[model samples]
Target: MNKVAIITGGGSGIGQATALRLAEEKVNIVVVDVNEKGGNETVELVKKLGVDSIFVKADVSKQEEVKNYVKKAVEKFKKVDYFFNNAGISGSGKFYLDTSLEEIDQIVGINLMGALYGARYVAECMLKSGGGSIVNTASSAGVIGQDSVVTYSATKHGIIGLTKSLVAEYAKDGLRVNAIAPGPTETPMVREFYAANPEMKENATGGIPQKRLGTPEEVAELVTFLLTSKAQYINGEVVRIDGGFTNTK
Candidate 1:
């Protein structure tokens, strides 16, 4: 049987790239996102690769919607071999004291809680199906400190914690849980930030040791490996994909 994967945020960025990459490997993809147009587009791309694909519209913050995503994936594919809990938002990118509670709540709800929801639901399904792997989309902000993005950093840190906890909870059941922390990635969220403050982009890129932004495909490659047998021993870890940005000055 072909392996099956359910990817949240499969509408764009790392999630979208991962969907196509996995499909090319003969894995069935369930692309879940709140954006119907982008989600459908991703499914179409996956289908073009000659693999089965379905688009699931879900707001990861809503338990009912999140549950529905898992239900559909199970009903249609019978089992889940992999899960990419990649849905997230950049929050308001504000300072700690200056940031409002509303922005903090929004960031926590989507970035942190959204991932937990997917992890809990997908891990259970994987247990029933024998075993599987799960990758959470965290940020380099999770590993290191960032003065400007207080709430965003906090939420990503929470994701890292979730990844480790779930790995412990499910490892004995043949389930693997891990997280990828990417630094200065080239995604829609990054593009929007650069467009709004062009100078900030230059400063941010210059700070990185690579002196450039990472691509979604580059990050997706690492995540794809984590979900494969080659990485069966890997779990409860946050792999950094930041091109030395976090390690270097």
Candidate 2:
């Protein structure tokens, strides 16, 4: 039987790349995103790779929307073998004092709360099916501290907490939950952020041991390995794919 995966934020960047990678593995995908165009584009791209794919437009921060996505995935694929709880938004790249309260709420809503909702609903569906693997998106800011992204950093740290706590409560029940902390990845989201803060981009690249930004395809590869049976023994782990970016700090 073909495995199924639900990737939140599947419309673009790491999420989209992971969807394509998993499709290559013959996994049916549920691409969930608020951007209808990008979400549908992912569905069509995966279908061309010969795997069944569907798009579920959702705002992952909303509990009901998150629930609906999980329910829809079960209706179509019957089981969720993997989940990439990767929906998030980087804030406006301002210091905490300069950041607006509304911005803080927005960032927390999508990044931290959305991830929480996803893990809640998706894990339930997976446990019902015996067990499954989940990979949540964390960040370099999550593992350590970085200036200019206090709210984004806080939410990512919360993601790590979510990943570990879920495993503690449910690993024995057959749920494998893990998180990835990527540094300076060249995703559309990151690109847009860096475009506005060009100086920060240069500083980021210089600090990385690799001296360059990471790619979504590379992050996708890590997520794929972690989500598949190859990583069955791995759980409650926060794997850093930051190319020594956090190491320097």
Candidate 3:
């Protein structure tokens, strides 16, 4: 039987790249995102790779939608071998004091609450099937700290806690939960963030020892390995893929 994965935010960026990468291994995919066009595009790409895939348009912030996506994945694929709980927003690049309450709610709703809802339901299903793996998208800000992105940082930090705690509770039950903290990866979301905060981009690249933003494909490689049985011994770890960006600080 082929493995199956459900990638939230699979419409673009790291999620999209990971979907394609896993599809290359013949894993059936369930692409979940709010953007129908991008989600369909990912499905098409996966299909061209000769793997069965489907798109589930959902607002991960809402628990019902999160549950529906898990239900749909189970209905279509019978089991979820892996889950990329990667849907999130970067919030307006405003100073913490200047950031609005609305922005904080929006970031927390989607980035933090959405991840928890997805993991809650997906873990239940995985527990039923004996075992599964999950990778949550954390950020460089999640590990250390940055000037801006307070709300975004909080959510990503919450993600790291979620990853570790889930494994702490469920490792014996055959669940492996891990997180990836990437440093300014080149993704559509990151591009939009940089476009809004251009100066920060130069600062970020300059700060990284590699002097360049990481690529979605590079992050996808790490995610794929963690999601597969090859990483069976790995659990509850937050692996940093930030080209020495966090090392200096």
CA lDDT of every candidate: 0.89, 0.95, 0.96
Residue 177, candidate 1: C-alpha displacement in angstroms? 0.6
User: What are the runs in model 1 whose C-alpha is more than 4 Å off?
Assistant: none
Model 3 worst lDDT window (10 residues): 138-147
Q: How would you encode candidate 3's per-residue C-alpha lDDT over 1-249 as one tens digit per residue?
A: 899999999999999999999999999999999999999999999999999999999999999999999999999999999999999999889999999999999999999999999999999999998989999999889999888999999999999999999988999999999999999999999999999999999999999999999999999999999999989999999999999999999
Model 2 spans > 4 angstroms off: none
Evaluate candidate 1 by giving its C-alpha RMSD to the native, one decimal. Answer: 1.1
| TM-score for each model | 0.97, 0.99, 0.99
In angstroms, the error of model 1 at 16 is 0.6
Candidate 2 residue-wise lDDT, 75-151, digit = tens: 99889999999999998999999999999999999999999999988888889879899999999999998999999
lDDT of 3 at 160: 98
For candidate 3, list the clashing residue pairs, or say none.
none
Lowest lDDT sum, 10 consecutive residues, model 1, at 90-99
- Please give the lDDT score at residue 51 for candidate 2: 94
